[model samples]
Structure formats: C-alpha cells, structure tokens
Target: MDKFLKMTGFATSIISWYNINKRDLPWRQNASPYHVWISEIILQQTQVKQGLDYYNRFISLFPDVVSLANASQQDVLLAWQGLGYYSRARNLHAAAHQIVERYNGVMPDTYAELINLSGIGPYTAAAIASIAFGEPHAVVDGNVFRLLARCFSVELPIDTGEGKRFFTNLANELLDSTNPGDFNQAMMELGALVCTPANPDCAICPLRTMCNSYRLGNPFSFPVKSRKTTKRDRYFYYFVHESDKQLAITRREKGDIWQGLWELLLIESDKRLSENQIVRQLSESLNMAPLAVSHVVEMRHLLTHQNIFASLHKVKMPEKFNLVTFKDKIVVYTGRENLTDYPLPKLIEKLLAQYFDLPPKVL
Candidate 1:
C-alpha cells in the first residue's frame, strides 16, 4: 500500500505541474484526435517552434482525414516541403488513406489499433492512445526516458533494447490513470522546460526533492544513450534550365531524398566536381548543350545522417523541350508562374526565391 501510494503521488505531482506550466500549443489546445495526430507526427523529427507553422499549414490545407486522403500525394508532399523526413509525410498520407478505407474515417482509439497504421510507431501509438483516448498507455519518448532515468538515478543505457523495455515498464507504472493525458503531457513538459539536456535547472524543478540525480549533484548523468551518428557528405549539381519565361524540373522518385517532390535537373557525384565536368555532364545528359552555364552559390542541407553540399548551375536551354518524359512515373516539365504548385526541396526552393525572385509562401 505504501509503494502504491508513492507511485500515485509521483503521477499526481507531474499532473499538477503540467496543468499550470505547460506551453499553450495549438495541438494541445483542443486535444482533438486529428489535431494531436498531425501535431505529434510533425513534431517527431522537428521541434515545437519549427513545426508550428507547418502544422498550421497542414491543418489549413488538409483540415481532416478525408481531405488529406482525397488529395494527391504530390499535394501532400508540397505542403510538407520544408519539414524534411519526407517519409513521415508520405506515411501520414498513406495512413490517412488507410484510416478512411479500413477504419471508416475514424482514428483508431487504442494503441494496438493505432500501431497497425503505416507511420504510427510504438511511441506515436502510445502518445495518441494515451492523450487522445485517455488510455493510460505510457509514452516513452526521449524526454520521458531522460526524466525517468535521472529522477530514479538509473544508469541503464537508454539506447539499448533492454534499457528501453525497462523504462517503458517504469513509465507504465507511473501513469496516472485518472488523468493520463495531463500526466503524459506534464512529464514531457518537465523534460522540455526544466530537465533540459545541459545545465538542468534543479532549483525550480518540481520533482527535484525526490530526484536521485539531483541528490547526487549530477542531474545530467542519467539517461545514458549509445550510438553516435556519422554523417556522410553528398554532392548534388542542379541545373536550372530556363527558356523564355519557363523553368525545367524533374519529379524525384524511388529511393531518393525529397521523393515525389519536384526539383531542377539534378546530376549527383561522389566528390568535389569541377565546373567543366558539370558542364560536360549536363551537355551529355540533356542530349543538347546549354546555350549558357553560370555557376550559382553552393548550398548545404543537413539530414539526420547525411550532409548534402549542392551547387546550383543555371543553364539556359532553348525553348524546345518544354516537356520531357524521361521514363515511367517521372515527369519533367517547364513552369514559370506555377513552380510553387509542385513541392520542392528547401535548397531548390530557396534558390528559386533568391535567384528567380519568386515570392516566399505566405502563411
């Protein structure tokens, strides 16, 4: 009885702290299933501040599952242009279709049912199930793992499977069944606001009194994780073929970054490429040498494990190949005013806004 009461008090403390201290996010406002679903997925790879506008854009465009399901994949990808981890967008779209077809436009209310969706992993499944449905499923995200490990002074490496299972069970035990939504959000809020990665403010932390790591004078020591990512550098050469008032672009397809998004004619290489080699390569690939080739600025885009260093080469092609069908499922075309209609990678999008003076997308 004493042990149970302590666990109960732990959950209550988190819930009380969360109710007053949580940030006023758009997704957490209404707490609707669809709203929570969209916000959580966007935030999976992106931070709250970075993902806010994207979530608003998605909500404005798709609004709900039926709208997202009815829209073409290209449209969905275009809306998610800058957010990156494009597979998440693709999976969201696929999951929407699945929900419409299988679940009759209703989101699955349980972790078991939600986990069967395309992009709904165990973490996401728990978040949605607990917060939306009040299912009391413990969400063991990075924030939760950090808080639990430090609060209890557990030394288990959180990156390992054994550590994950241990912490997951711990989280489940600490869930406040009466108010799972508030408890889960409060725990995440504690990590995001108080127990940060560096120099955690132990003085104002609500759980500091009982925190074992704080007692030990090293609040940052717990939640030890293994595996550091090694980034590989890639070189991309994009040729901007312009004729009269039109620009040429190709739809990236299959096993590539920005999959399903439209980009300028791309020629990738393994190493630092010379301008002459770029010109020669473009000439050979296009089957007609560009009238003029001017090198633009080099741009760097960082992914989870890849760092792309790309250079823009604006080529002037004659107004002949206005539309080129290179192969099945890939369409290359020229556009002047409707370029933004199709989604583009951030690097390409920024270049168009800079070089071509195309206006940025308004919120």
Candidate 2:
C-alpha cells in the first residue's frame, strides 16, 4: 500500500473506533477551551480514573478562567491537595491569571499563543488547539508516543530529542485534519484503553492490522527510553509541637518539593539520623528544649525522583512559651481543628488522619 493510503486507513479506523467506543467523560461532554485546558493539566501526571473527582471539584470551584484567576493561590492549592506534583497546580493558577490579563479572560485559540501561557507545553497546547479550537495540531503525549512507536516499530529512544521530533512529525502526518478533535482523542483513548504499557489488548486495537510491533510479537519493546531515573533517599523529621490545642505548622519554601503547601515543623536530613541526633538538632534549631518528645509515626513517601522516609514526632512545649519567639521565621501556630483549611502535603495529610485523629478528606 502507498504510505499515504495506509496512513489514511489507520486514521479512519482509529476515528471510527473512537466514535463507537470512546468513554463518556465529563470533559468530553463539553470541550470548552477552559474545560479541555483544566482536564489536560490535571491529567498530566495522573490517570483518568484518579483525576475525575479532582476535575469535577476543580471545575465546580473555579468554573472558568476568570474565576480561577481571581481565586487565591492557597485556595487553588487546597483544591489540588491530593493530586501531587503541586507545581502543576501552581502553574495552572499562574496560567489562569495570564489568560485573564493577556487575553481578557479568553483562552487563546492558536497553538502558538496557547504554548506561551504558563504550564501549557507543546502537548497540552496541541491538545487544546485541536480538541477545543478545531485546529490541526497533533498532540504527542505518552499515549500517542506509544501508539506511534508500536504501530511503526520505531526503536529510537523516546527520551532523546531526535526521537521526539520524529514521532511528533509522524503523528502530524497521520492526523485526520478534517476531524482533528475526535482523531486526537481517539489516538489517546486507543492507547489508554487498548495499547497500554503492560499487556496491550492488540486483539481489539483498530491499528493491530498495521502494527509492526504486533507482527513482531514485541508490542512492549517499541516505545524505548534511553534514560533511567535515579531516586534519592531523603529523611524528614516533623516535630508536631502542640500547646493549648494549637499545632505548629509552616509553609514549605520555594526551592523544595511541596512548595506553597503547609506542613508541620520539619527537619530534613540527607541520611536517616538516630533519635539522639534528631533531638539535638531539634534543640539547636528551636533554641529551647522540648518538655517531652515521643515518636508518633513513620511513613515512606515516594516522588518521581525522591524517596522520603518521614518520621512524625510529638513535642510538648512549655505552657507559657511563644511560638512566635522561635528563630525559625516560617513557624506559625494554628488551631488543631483548622489544619484542614490549609493545603497540606499528602504525607502530612495522611499523618494527620492516622495519628492526629483528623477526619480523612474524601476528595
């Protein structure tokens, strides 16, 4: 078959399969520019099933760009609590403000303009442009990458710049320009539901007839990556100082993980430390001795590039002491009941639920 004819058949099969088999999602119900943008951002590092509730809540809270722009960053972060990779939330908030300011509360329709907005990368911009604005841009997310790599049996490392460009161009060539929105969604849906990373269901795939990887019986081997991630181990000691039903908390600074989120007073170390070492460091940092100290809980939190071994300890302060007098400028005292009002890291949230008797958040 001629290359163009073969590609047309592939796209037609994908679009037909999608129209018949696509999942009925809330975002698909109304592919407004705002809805698509929000859904895409939320789904960046998250699965569809996990992001659904977050999306509903987020849309309910800030239904449009103007509302999102007007809301406080803390409120946005609070709504985004459980969905980690907090930078995405922050960037979404930033982009909302940008859209409001630059475009007068209107989402830019062009791919070039959308890409310039905060947190809107090539894939996201393409998604919005094609899905929301009827542009011919092809989205090349992990799903599309895997689909194209397997269909053509491309072995280039996806982590490399060369591999990215090749796959991107191929996706553009294969895109059905007349129906870019459904076509893009179809490509992604097929990858998510059928061409999964582990044990793809080639039997139901529309492209299986032309999939080189299926013919070679190595569907899992085509989407190759050159780089291996090395995760660093970190130890976090959280001292929950309570006095008169108040708990000490602090906002994480800009240069670290969970930035802009609130947490208990923390002492971070590169390596795990003994109890005596923890106590000595706490004393030195706080500039006073705790009346009593006891371990509460220990949890292992995993991030993309880091493994955090967090230990929570209860520290009893003197009855007359003032938290404001502490040398650590970030420390602040809040009512124990009000901890839920502030956005907290998942580890801290779990600690509160398990050890502090706080009700677990449903969303």
Candidate 3:
C-alpha cells in the first residue's frame, strides 16, 4: 500500500475503534477548552482512574480560569493534596493567573498561545489545541510514543531530543487533519487499551496487521529509552512535639521537596540517625530535654528522583515548657484537632493515620 493510503487506513481504524470503545469520561462529556486544559494537566503523571476524583473536585472548586486565579496558592495546594508532584499544581495556579490577565480569563485557542502558558508544554498544548480548538496538532504522550514506536519499529530512544522530534513529525504526518480531535484521542486510547507496554492485546489491535514490531514478534522492545533514573535516598526524622493539647507544625520552606506543605518538626540528616543521636539533636535544638522520647514508626516514601526514609517520633515536652521558645523553628502551634485544616505531604499524612490515629480526609 502507498504510505498515504496506509496512514489513512491507520487513522480510520483508530477513530472507528475509539468511537465505540472509548471510555465514557467526564472530560469527554464537555471538551471545552478550560475542561480539557484542567484534565490534561491533572493527567500528566496521573492515571485516568486516579485523576478522576481530583478532576471533579478541582473543577467544582475552581470551575474557570478566573476562579482559579483568584484563589490562594495554599487553597490550590490544599485541593491538590495527595496528588504528588506538587509543582504541577503550582504551575496550574500560575497559568490561571496568566490566562486571566492576558487572555481575559479565556483559555488560549492556538497551540502557540497555549504553550506559552506556565507548565503547558508541547504535549499538553497539542492536546488542548486539537481536542478543544479543532487545531491540527498531534499530541505525543507516553501512550502515543509507544504506539508509534512499535507500529513503525523505530529504534530511536524516546528519551532523546532527536527521538522526540522524529515521533512528533511522524504523528503529525499520520494525523487526520479533518478530525484531529478524535484522531489524537483515538491514538492515545489505542495505546492505553490495546498497544500497552506489556502483554499487548495484538489480536484486537487496529494496526496489528501493519505493525512492524508485531510482525517481528518483539512489540515490547520498540519504545526504547536510553536513560535510567537513579533515585537518591535521604533520611527524615520527624519529631511530633505536643504541649498542652497543641501540636507543633512547620511549613516546609522553599527550595526543598514538599514545599508549602505542613509537617511535624523535622530534623533531616544525610544518614539515618540512632535514637540517642535523635534525642541529642532534639535537646540541643529545643534547648530542653524531652520528657519522654518514644519511637513511633518508620516509612519509606518514593518520589520520581528521591527515596525518603522517614522516621516519626513522639517527643513529650515538659509540663511547663513553653512552645513559644521555639517560635523560630516551629511555624505554627495548632490544636491537635485542627491539623486537618493545613495541607500535609503524603508521608506526614500517612504517619498521622498509622501512628497518630488521625485519619486523612477524603479529598
């Protein structure tokens, strides 16, 4: 078959399959520019099933660009709690302000204008442009990359700049210009459902007959990556200090993980500290020995590039000890019952639930 004819067949097969097999999602119910933009941002490092509730809650809270822009950053982060990679939430808030100021509270229609917004990169820009605005821009996310790499048997590493360009051009060439919205969604849906990373359902794949990797019987090996991520481990010692029914908490400072989130008094160390070492550090920092030092529990928290080994401890202060003495170190002294009002990192939240008997609220 001629290349053009084959491409047309590929697109037609995908769109037809999508029309019948596509999951009924809230975002698909209304492909408005604002809805698509929010869904795309939420789904970047999140699965559809997990992101569904967050999307519903976020839309309910903010509803539109103006509402998001007017809200405080803390409120946005609070709404986005438990969804890791907090930078995405921060960027979304920033972009909302940008949209309100520059575009008069309307999402930009063109790919160029959309991409210029904070955190709206090529894939997101293409998604919003094509799906929401009917622009002929192909989105190349993880799903699309896997589908194209295997179908064409491309060996270029998907992590490299050159490989990304090659796939972007190929996707655009194969894009159905007349129906770019469904075409892009069809490609993504096919990859997500059929042409998966492992154990692909090739028998029902729309492009199985023409897939080069399928013919070679090595479908899993086509989407190549040249780089491997190495996660660095750090130890965190979180001291839960309580005095007169008030708990000491601090907001994580800028230039660190979990920035803008609240946590117990923290003593981070390059290496894990012994119990004695923890006591000594705490005594020195607070200028008073803890009345009782009880080891609570340890948990390992994983991030994209970091592995945190966190230890939670309870440090009972003396009866007459004043929390005001450590005002510089402790940002807030809130009643034990009011900790839920402050947004906390997942690690801290888990610690509270497992050891402190404070249940996390359903977001």
Candidate 4:
C-alpha cells in the first residue's frame, strides 16, 4: 500500500508537470480523431520537430479522413515523400480506404478496432484510442520504455521479449486510470523532455525523488538494449534519360526501396557493375540502345539497416520514344514545370538538384 501511494504520487506529479510544460503542438488542439491519428503516425519513426511540418502539410492536403481516402496513391506518397519508410505511407493509404469503405469514413472508437486497421500497431492504436477517444490504454513507445526503465532501474534488455512484457505490464499497472489520456501524454512528454537517452536532466525531473536510477546515480544504466541490427550493403545504378523537354521516371512497383513512389530508372545489385555491364543491363531493361552512357556522379546513402552505394549515369536514348510505350509501367514528366509535383526519393531529389543547379531540400 505504501509503494502504491508513491506510484500514485509519481503519476500525479507527472500530470502537473506536463500540464505546465508540454509544447503547444497542433494535434493537441482538438479531439479530432483524424488529427490525432495523423500526428501519431507521422511521429512513429520521425522526430516531433521534423514531423510538425509534414503533419501540417498532410492535414492541409488531406484535411479529413474522406479527403485522404479519396486521394490517389501517388498524391499520398507525394505528401509523405522524403519522410522515408515508404511502407508507412502505403499502409496509411490502405487503412484510410479501409476506414472509408468499412465504417463510412468514421474512425473506430475502440482500441480493438483501431489495432485491426492497417499501419496501426499496439503503440499507435493505444495513442489514438487514449488521446482521441479517452480510452485507458497505456502507450509504450521508445520514450516510455526509456522513462519507465530508468524510474524503476530495470536492467532487462529492452529489445528482448521478456523485457518488453515486463515494461508493458508495468506501464499498464502504473498508468493513471482516471485521466488516462493526460497521464499517457505526461509520461511520454517527460521522457521526451527530461528523461532523454543521454544526459537526462535529473535535477529538474519531477520523478527525481522516487526514481530508482536517479538515487543510484546511474540513470543511463537502465533500459539496457544490447542487440544491434546488421546492415547490408546494396549498389544502385540509376540512369537519367531525357527526351526533349520531357524526362522519364518509373514507379517502384516491386517491394523495394521507394516503393509506390516515382524515381529514375534503376538497377539494383549486390556488386557494383562496370560501365559496359551497366550499358548492357540498361539496354536490356529499356529494350533499346543508348546513344551514350556517361558516369555523372556517385553517392553513399545510409538507411536504418542498409548502406546504399549508388552511381548515377546519363543515358541518351537513340530517339524520343512514345510516352505511351512506358505508360503502363512508368511515368513521363512533361517538363520542369511539373517535375516537383510528383514525389521523389531523397537520393533522386539530390540528383535533380545537381541537374538543375538548385539547392537540395530534405525532409
């Protein structure tokens, strides 16, 4: 009973601190289910600072659930371009369509229903249900994991199944049941603001008095995550082809990088190919001979678990072929005026900046 009292006090203190210190984010302005849903999805693998503009831009482009459901996949991908993790955009699109078709454009009110939707896992569904619908589900994101681990000085490896189950159960037990939404936000905000991964501000932390790791003078020792993902190296050889004022790009229909988005013609391989090999491969893929193949540039792009060593080449086609020939498989942008309208990968965007002599903007 004594420990439970301390737990209640700790939860209440976090609420007070969050009420005073939380940032004025746009999503918190209302109980609009769509707004909460969008913000949560955007922040899944993205930072709040980087995610804010995307959220606003997305909300503007697709103001409501119906608008998002009605939008073409390309337009949705364009909105989500440069954010990386292309599958998230695709899943979000599929989920929007599901919601519209299944629920008449109404978001499901329960956590169970939200979890069944595409792109939403336990964390996302919990966030949306609690904050948007006042449900009592506890959200256990990375921030929450870090905070709770330190507060209790749990040394279990956070990446392991045993550790996940332990922390998840603890989160549910300690969550403020009365004002669950505020408590959830408070816990998340504290972790974001005070219980950071490195150099946590213990002096100003609200939970300092009751925090086990803080008392032990080793807050970083908890939340031990020992496993590291192995990264595979890939080589991408891209060919830029131009015909008159029009340039040709292709949609990544295969389950690969930049899937569902448009990019320059590409050939991916385990090993980097020589110029002759590239020319031959390009010839086979395009089914036509190129007038010239010149090495333009090479870049090293790093993803979450992959290192992409890419080489760009300029291919001059024998003649301008009809866009209709590639229409079924690819997209042909007519001119520079319409180039920015389509979504492109960051790597391709960098190549375009070089082609046009313009500054590169990244999301």
Off by over 4 Å in 1: 1-7, 318-331, 357-363
Q: Looking at model 1, which ten-residue stretch has the lowest summed lDDT? A: 322-331
Q: Please, what are the lDDT tens digits per residue for candidate 1 over residues 20-44?
A: 8889998887788889999989988
| Runs off by more than 4 Å, candidate 2 | 1-6, 325-327
lDDT for each candidate structure = 0.83, 0.89, 0.88, 0.85
State which candidate has the highest lDDT. Answer: 2
What is the Cα-based lDDT of residue 38 in candidate 4? 92
Worst 10 residues of 2 by lDDT: 320-329
Ranking under TM-score, best-scoring first? 2, 3, 4, 1
RMSD of each: 2.6, 1.7, 2.1, 2.5
Off by over 4 Å in 3: 1-6, 324-330
Give the C-alpha miss distance for residue 103 in model 4, angstroms: 1.8
Using TM-score as the measure, the top candidate is 2
lDDT per residue for candidate 3 within 140-227, as digits (tens), equals 9999999999998889999999999999999998999999999999998998899988779999998888888879999978799998
Worst 10 residues of 3 by lDDT: 322-331
Off by over 4 Å in 4: 1-6, 321-333, 361-363
Instruction: In model 3, state the lDDT of residue 91.
Output: 93
